[model samples]
Target: MNQLDQLKKYSTVVADTGNVELIKKFSTQDATTNPSLILNAIKLPKYKNLLLKSIEYAKKKNINLKETVSLASNKISVDIGTKILNFIPGRVSTEVDSRLSFNKNLCIFHAKEIIRMYEENGIKRNRILIKLASTWESIQAAKELEKENINCNLTLLFSFAQAKACAQSGVFLISPFVGRIYDWHINKYNLDSINIENDPGVKSVKKIFNFYKKYSYKTIIMAASFRNINQILELSGCDYLTISPTLLSELKSNFNKIDKKLNFTIKNKTYKNKITEEEFRFEHNEDIMATEKLSEGIRQFGYDQKKIEDIIIKNI
Candidate 1:
């Protein structure tokens, strides 16, 4: 069997793209999209209809140009998410705006608005996972949303403290970014040669995985932001892997035997006591790599969102 097929035996593969057509080609069980991916997708000629459709809705409501652009910017995500649902059997993750990541109330409000937009188009809430950055506010928002029966996918996660907070908050899923973590260490140490076996990113996910299993936490660990297939292969038995189409293609073409590198079995294990909010903040602040990467990821997403809005504003 091909590596893709073999990997599927151990994990649920999720397409990490805004392009539904590419997702269809891979037969990914689920799909995830963020402001960055949606921004990139809108520039493509094929996804041009989503923009035009949003504009049409704004016009029909007699909204002004500024309002039209804002509405279109928000609606475009739902339009694409609705389209993606037609191809995949499982859930589609739609992210809340990164600008709202630090504001718990705003995050909750926008998350509800995104879900409302999806529901307006006949898609059910269960088919969607609201993506949020793993900030204290966002995790708190996720806790409230979960109480209302809304599942969330916590993204931009790096540190074990972030993972611990999410699990304690009863988050539905947490995406520990493997490639971004690896990138931070790779550049920091300026290493000439590296061992994939002892990859820092892989070890981070394994640590979280062991903690989850040892304590029997229900939050699913989906490794994201992979730089190479080796990172993905090493994390073969993770709960879910949201892989890019580029790497998916690489795995599809390579017919190699993939092994399950992670196992979740209970042993004589002990985990740290659940952390307080102050402790969570202090630990996250201390991890320079996590602090820098988390901030950078949010800024990049916010930048792409502005770019997408600029494009819509131009048409308006």
Candidate 2:
């Protein structure tokens, strides 16, 4: 069996792309897309049809030209996600606006809007995971949406505090960015070299996985944003791994035996610790890397979103 097949024995492989062809090639069970990925995809010549189709759909609905940016962005996501859904048997995550990361009400409002768009096109809510940044507000918004049977995938999660909050709030899944965490440590420490076994990003996910397992938190852990195959292999037994096409292709080419790296069992740990809003903020602040990465991830996504909106406005 190829490494990709072996990895699938232990984890559900998700394609981390906006390109339907790539997702189909990998036969990924699920797929995830963000503003950056969508923006990048529409810029490609092959995906230009998707971009034009989204704008046309919005225009036909009598959407305001001035607000085409927002509508175009949302339609593009749904259009891509709808396409992806036809190929993949499982869910496709469509993220809410990163600019609304801190606003609970707006996040909820947009999340529903995104889901409604999917449902309007005949995709059930069960097959969609609303992607949200791992902000406290976003988590709270996810909790409320969960009550209405809307599952969420919390992205840009960098710290244990964020994971704990998500688990406590009863989210469906949390995506801890393995590559981004490693990038921060390598740049900050100025390390000429580092051990993959002891990679900071790898360890962060391990910690969260162990805690979640030990305490029996039902929120799924999907380690994501991998820089290499080693990081993906390291978390082989995670609940899921959303991987890019580059690494997925690498795995598909290598017919090697992949070993499971994570195992879960109940251990000595208290599952219940009510984290107040102040404590949550303080704990997140104490982790320098998480603090910096979370903010940076939001800013970059917001910038990409704005760029896509600009493209829509220009087209109008």
Model-by-model lDDT, in order?
Answer: 0.91, 0.92
TM-score per candidate? 0.95, 0.96
Lowest-sum lDDT 10-residue window in model 2: 63-72
lDDT of 2 by residue, 166-242 (tens): 99999999999999999999899997656888899999999999889898788999999999999999899999999
lDDT of 1 by residue, 226-287 (tens): 98999899999999999999999999999978889889776545455888999999999999
As a whole number from 0 to 100, the lDDT of residue 272 in candidate 1 is 58
RMSD of each: 1.9, 1.6
Global local distance difference test of model 1: 0.91
On TM-score, the candidate that comes out on top is 2
Clashing pairs in 1: none
